[model samples]
Target chain A: MTGLKKTILGISDMKNLFQSLNNNYSIDLSNYALSSLKSRVEDFMFNYHFSSIDELIHKVESDASFFQLLLNKVLVETTEMFRDPEFWNFLKINILTRNNYQNELKIWIPECNSGEELYTLQIIIHQLNLQHKIKVCLTTLSPLNIERITKANLEIKKMEINCANFERYQEEGNLEEYFTNKANSFKLNPEIIENAEIISHNLFSDKIPGIFDLIIFRNKMLYYNPSLKIDALKILNTGLKPGGYIAIGIKESLDFPGWDQEFTVISESERIFKKIIRKEE
Target chain B: MSYKYIIIGGSAGSFQTVTNILASLPQDFSMPIFLCLHRLKHVRAGFVEALSIKSNLKVIEPNDKEYIRQHKVYLAPANYHMYFELGNYIGLSTEQAVNHSRPSIDISFASAAYTYKSKLIGIILSGANKDGAYGLSQIKENGGLTIVQDPEECQVKTMTSAAISATNVDHVLKANDIIQLLLKLQNKHF
Candidate 1:
């Protein structure tokens, strides 16, 4: 019982420290200011709560699982397959206008939480009948995603009936009857899932794999600190082929530090940007 | 008061969120609604049929230069944003994410604030990011009506709480109650 209280108090203190750190980064976490100002470090004398936030940080210092745990607790995983219908149509009609099915186009989905958005991209390619033509790759992993993949890939060449509920990518309601149901819920046609590759990687910690023709990192940026966001964007821009397109969540953007000049937004409202390839110096 | 248009933002349970709220409205609902949920830059899917089947409003994945027709819903067509030019054609943008969001609640709300002013109704629903707080305030500042989902009804209140703390919101109601309010606004004096 005492241990639980100590942990809670320790967590509260860490929240304070992290809050302060956030404020320092120019994110106004002003609400905690009054409490922080009133409680001096001396007030912590009676606090048997794990020394300080520093102690907790030390515990997590070498914990590779810390990030994995952080992923499960913090990331948002609510995504549907082929979210915006027309944008897929737009891509077919406007950008990939050529009828050459033999030309290989590469697409990337960064920050692909639990593989829903990545699989959804393949569904779009399938829906547009562009599947046989392009190669799709996904990078990024949240704890929920890693968990989902670990669970999904466990013990079967394919999913079981109940696994449908976990396939938030296949979608739900009204459109349930629109597509063939597999593994249970509205299963994304197996072919679409097969067309794309989902991998575990971090834009912040890992190397930006290679140049691609397109990249999508939707809704994942809003959660990042400004500097982290900038770093993520810089790495993303570096991974883009000269004319590669980069897409972010409806709310995420490239406007950050280290977000050096590279891409211009294709449509500001949709959060789609095209890599603006620079000329030689 | 009646509005020429309405805009909404949300995340998490928002998949069923918009459906549950809008399904109760009339099939021929006369007002135009531009829906902007927090979504990715990947090819958009499922929104049209999911929401369209629930509401009588003609849900469409609008194209660039599509007119903002009355009695219709304009879904952000994916990899793009749905914006208005003073009741003119609804325009699509591939602009950078604002507050790290595309189909940004802020962008849509800001555009409405910038263009429609008092004639717009801006709403904030459930989600994780602090995306629409400033834009909703802008709508209120410009004489437009502002509505926020009651944090209690939200599956995740962090998003709405940010907006609530950020702005002096005009109405805070449960998700169902918000639907009731919108219906009332439709019938009330403009």
Candidate 2:
């Protein structure tokens, strides 16, 4: 009984700490999932050797520089190249190679965390030899992530899955062809990085780029609240050109209200939707 | 202490045991249930339907960022890891599969333990893998209640035995006793 009460009290204390941080920093973290946020914050505290949440909160109030570290930790990127190989195959075969929108391709990767998805897209574009026709824009909210993406070095550990996914997609090129082996990492081809223009833009506050032929915003909605996701979907709708295909993570869906009015499912299994053209009067 | 959520994790040879337990649960069971059973990425359809065929509570395969409600069994959809968002909604992820299972039990259980703390009741059932062991330990560490299916009673004892070895479990109950415990907890609370 005492233990249960203590845990309840501990949760309340942690909530209060977050509330304090919100009030002081003007950073609204209510949109992030509490469990993930809590885990990240706890990890941050542990790394910094803060004995308690109150101590961490006190440090944040005292030092302005600590906020950036906190932000970097909280928004840590989790991505892998060629994740869900079948989806990549579908994009390559159905969208890229198909002659539907063959004039020129403008690809927007919103929330391209640390550039794995961006690099994956680049690899596909390279394979198709469509580099000249394709203009890629990758956007993220975190400057730290933008810097990491700019580095273009992927951890060597990800090679196993990346290789497996490539083989599953039956992708033509060898994996080693695009990367130079570093001591503990693999540096991506500089030409591919040059192809992408990485920008720092907040999904909530900043304006997205102009109409894109395809916008990939995979696995990002899971971090948001349901209402926030609805708003984000509405905003993302404006960033797409008519007939533009938008691919979300396979587990995600466009089931929000009025989603059907704007887009239709192009591939239900892969969760790709194409924007419908509504004639402007 | 009262629990706000019931979390169950299983792998091989668990479907029948889970269905049996779900069948015994009453319609008015108010605690939200999160289920993570290991399944292949390509096995995407009909899992919720199969589970709902025997369940009294609403059985659903939760979508990304969906608001969670009580008296509902939210099953982790294939190829996505399920986590609690803001302690009130379900968050689905396509981040690389852990333990070669997309809807990894450890990921969901760890997420649930962080959010609910002592207000969670975790159950580990029959399986071949040790995926749920670390997660059950996390739940127990957060002062939550944990029940491991008795290894002798499990169809495949590996998962259950691993869970028991990982932490000091509150109860080691077979399917029938587990069903009874859930009913008793329900009646005691609501």
Candidate 3:
């Protein structure tokens, strides 16, 4: 009966209706066009004073921008620096230090949500002292994500170092100490931002622009349907250079479509895969 | 004939599934029960709590070079793996995910099959992927009784189905029923 309840229910119903329509039409929601459509519903929901979610959806179908806002709300923002320590170790050992991508390393960290992963990679680069040497092109599914990363402020600086994770880092000789929170959270420097070219692209619809040396798109396939995972992987395969590496979140794998066959295990436990394409002399 | 070991693996819904299996297990049990569950990155040192909830066997994640003991449950710490070794312990590797799992069931099961041979009883339980299928089959190849949770009865069937499809499973049971199977096997020289 309350306005909040009405608004929530309205959004859910609208999403349900939208999803059903897409399903009926065999629409692939992974496409970039869905972003605009999602926004339209989000905008409609914002204006409604509906008492339930179902009613809110009914009221918001006509208005634009509501669904986008709703999608933002549903976005999962949970991430941490060096979320998995061993994987980074595997990267530092098996790929970063071993490979000659120093001046030419083009890393694409898709779905760089909430700046945690971006900062994480930055920490790795800083540790390896490759910040200015290697160029990393970061990509996200939403423009909002890029904005969140570049606009990352002093609030992050105030955060404290996770002593446990910091201890596990490869401890390369002659690097700055682990990050300290100045206040609120860690304040990121513009230099880190400058080294990385952040972009927004839909992996399922739009093509990934450049050839990448290492692709770390953690948790990319978790939100999608199974078919989308295969499609995304194909695109990823095309963009990655021969002998490049790709890392997924701990939960995801390339089993169904046999993507695993394309990669040699760098660290099978950390989900690191090296593209080992054959070349004829 | 003191060569029985228990191996269990899962993801997504593994935390709760392990709690049930460990609870069903008795303390001071004669055989060693080794467990591996695919965890999110940086899992806390909370495994002992889950294992202590029901079993008398002490539970803890293995250190990088730690030795494994009988009547104790050793969990592959987050981002690391647990492999069975013959010189009185399981070898922990900082290896990457085998089949998308750091503490891959297949890795643990395969190693157990190699070390324990017919004395091992491998069980594949709830999990999202097919990590343990091949490893369980390896255990079966070496003359061990292969027990898989019925895909229809599992909380998540992918791992169990992979196991069933890989080899002729000896027992396909539910979560609670697995405890019965364990007890049944333990009575026979374990």
Please tell me how candidate 1 rates in CAPRI terms: incorrect
- Candidate 1: lDDT of A19? 58
lDDT of 1 at B11: 70
- For A1-281, candidate 3 gives per-residue lDDT tens digits of 24442121223454575564365433335432222233334334555444445654444354445645554544544455666777777787777777675357888877555676777677778768877666777777667777778865534321333334555664543112443345455556666666778888766567677898889877555444445556777888889988888898654566547666778877666778888877788
TM-score (chain A only) for the predictions, listed in order: 0.63, 0.89, 0.75
Comparing 2 and 3 on TM-score, the stronger one: 2
Residues B5-94, candidate 3, lDDT per residue (tens digit)? 777767756667678777777775767777777776466556667667776678876543345666788776666556664455545543
Highest-lDDT candidate: 2
- For DockQ, the strongest prediction is 2
Q: Decide which is better by lDDT, 2 or 3.
A: 2
Better of 1 and 3 by TM-score: 3
Q: Return the interface RMSD of the candidates, in order shown, one decimal each.
A: 13.5, 2.7, 16.2
